[model samples]
Target: MKVACTEKSQILGSKVAKTLGLPLVYSQFKAFPDGELYLKTGALDGETLLVSSTADNQSLVQLLLMIDACDRSEITLVLPYMGYARQDKRFNDGEPISSRAVARALSAGVSRVITINIHEPSVLSHFRAPAIDITLAPEMARWVASLGCDEPIILAPDKGAVIFASEIAKHGGWEYDHLSKTRLSGEEVRIAPSSVDAKGRDIVITDDIISTGGTLATAAGMLKDGGARSVHAACVHGVFASGGFARLAAAGLASIAASDTIESAASSYTAAGMIAEAMRE
Candidate 1:
């Protein structure tokens, strides 16, 4: 079977296809000045995997169109980073759960789906197919340990991220703590460390997603202020929407690393092999 990728997702998808011994299928993508997207592929294949990360609006749109192109064959969708997942629930009465809109568009032509550490698995309910959700904390922990940095400490940006931090800590055989968050508003928050002294320690603030990055940046600042010698980040999906990357960098993160779950600059490494292994089963 041949494999292909949506415009933006080609980068990471190519890596996965290469690892799985599949040829990279190419398609043309461009838009008219009037806002219509044009898409085409050379020939039809029996089955095709359409890989794309919904990191932003353009990717989301391209994924929908590509699914239509695969009408002749079965389509398996791989979205390492799924956007709008955190908004699965409506915070207010009139607010729409954008995840449903995204899920509906995605499930339209796809036969199955796979994602890594989705913000919420309940969002899978939006898809009408066999879905698999996985994580990359195992690889991340191994990498962190190999780094052999000075006195290490694992910290979760907030209580919601504690589970991910815990996994990494378990993998590295280290200790961890969570930062409590009081969401003041959609864009404002207050954070407090639940335990542990980070002073002069190598603080690794970890999380699944980093959209806007307000939470991670704040925690990083606090860690430094509280006497932590350094701050680093290892996120599963670097969803740096709204220029959150610059903000996080400015917040004093020494080195930021992210798995290739999203098409971003920090995806120096990947866990696609693990993802494919799960799909193979």
Candidate 2:
């Protein structure tokens, strides 16, 4: 199998290729004067692992183009971060199921698909081809353990993320719990954990995706108010959509860390090894 990666995931792709003892294929990408994307791939045959993180519309287009360029090759897409996954359901009339649409588009050119810590696992059902959802919680836990905090505790921003928190805690052998969240608005939320007694404990809030960071900010503030010694945040996909990193910093979080799914400054760990192992399976 050969490995090829979109520009956004070059760093991670190289790592995965090295682990699998596969050669990394080079692809050229550029943009026209009017901002249209152009992509060309080198020779690829047999089973090929195409690694890409659809962080935005442009990267999605790039992946599609690359898939089309790899003529007749069996393509297995590795989407470290599947964008538009949050819109998996129709909340109102006339709303589009964005995740399904994206899945269909992706399935059109790939034999199988793999994603890391998608917002909704149900979204994988939309793909016509076989789809796999991999978790980065173990990688996150390993990174957290490297921090070497005296009294580390893993916290989920809301009940929905309890499983993720628990996985990290289990891997790190730390205490784990979840917060109750009340969404006041798109950019506002109220988070609390009945009685964590966070006093003097170093807390790490873990989640699958951190978009606006509102939930993390609120939870971190609450922990600090409860006398927590320090609060940090970790996630698989750190979208940081609207100044989220700044918002978390303003909320007094000691640091923000995430997997290299989106290639941001907060990416303290790489999901390459995990993805490589999944591909082997």
Candidate 3:
């Protein structure tokens, strides 16, 4: 009945603690002047939940430590955001599958795993333990509705994001569609819908993760070009690396929001309630 979490995921840990009616463990961690980490926490059980996020490389290391410390009991790791999943495959002869490395590290520590909106689901097989993937569809829909956007239209950045966008639209009783993506280069791409009229729709563009904001910005640009009145962006994990959000806004995105998977500045949502509910089964 104990709960623990990494620093990047404190935002999610807070909500999960509230929903589960449990207290968060007293864990103290600090970084040395040279940037080394020091951590200490109270006693724990085998039946514990470790809430974590993929905000940075450190969070992953912290999670591994927490899992090892909880050897006295079984552990369930809840990662609101999963990084490295995009590198699930070795596209080149000398390329390393970072996603598999991450999964292996995590599996060695915890007994089971949980995550939301992984960029590549196949990465789950890299883990030695069982893993579950959750979505923020119901939660995202509720928030968009709360924003008072009447019958919103959920737009996917690309085909990969259609499943998430469709679920959001389904929950909100809205319509959804995926824009097309044409990669111009390894780092450059273009996006536009094949056929859709979005002249006056309140569009909410969504995806699994927002890494460099290239896909989203490109997609939003196309929607607006096609007469979309307004374009907002949402995602389960907002990496926003190298000023991705700034780029998205510069490309004319109305707003940028994400769940507190990483310690990003735009984490306007939490998945604790959703995760707790899903775990009840």
Compare the candidates by lDDT and give the number of the best one. 2
Positional deviation of residue 8's Cα in model 3 after best superposition, in angstroms: 1.3
**1-281 per-residue lDDT for model 2 (tens digits):** 89999999998899899988999998889999999999888889888999999999999999889888876899999999998999999999999999999999989878999999889999999999999899998899888888879869888877778988998899867888888766789997556664576789999989998899986787788778878888999999989989999999999888899888999788899999899899878
TM-score of each: 0.91, 0.94, 0.91
Candidate 3 Cα RMSD (Å): 2.9
The TM-score of candidate 3 is 0.91
lDDT (0-100) at residue 279 of candidate 3?
Answer: 74
Error of 1 at 82 (Å): 1.6
Model 1, residue 204: C-alpha shift (Å): 0.5
What's the TM for model 2? 0.94
For candidate 1, the per-residue lDDT at 185 reads: 98
**How accurate locally is residue 148 in candidate 1, as Cα lDDT from 0 to 100?**
79
- State model 1's lDDT: 0.81
Clashing residue pairs in candidate 2 are none
Q: In model 3, what are the clashing residue pairs, if there are any?
A: 46-73, 46-74
Clashes of each: 0, 0, 2
- TM-score winner: 2
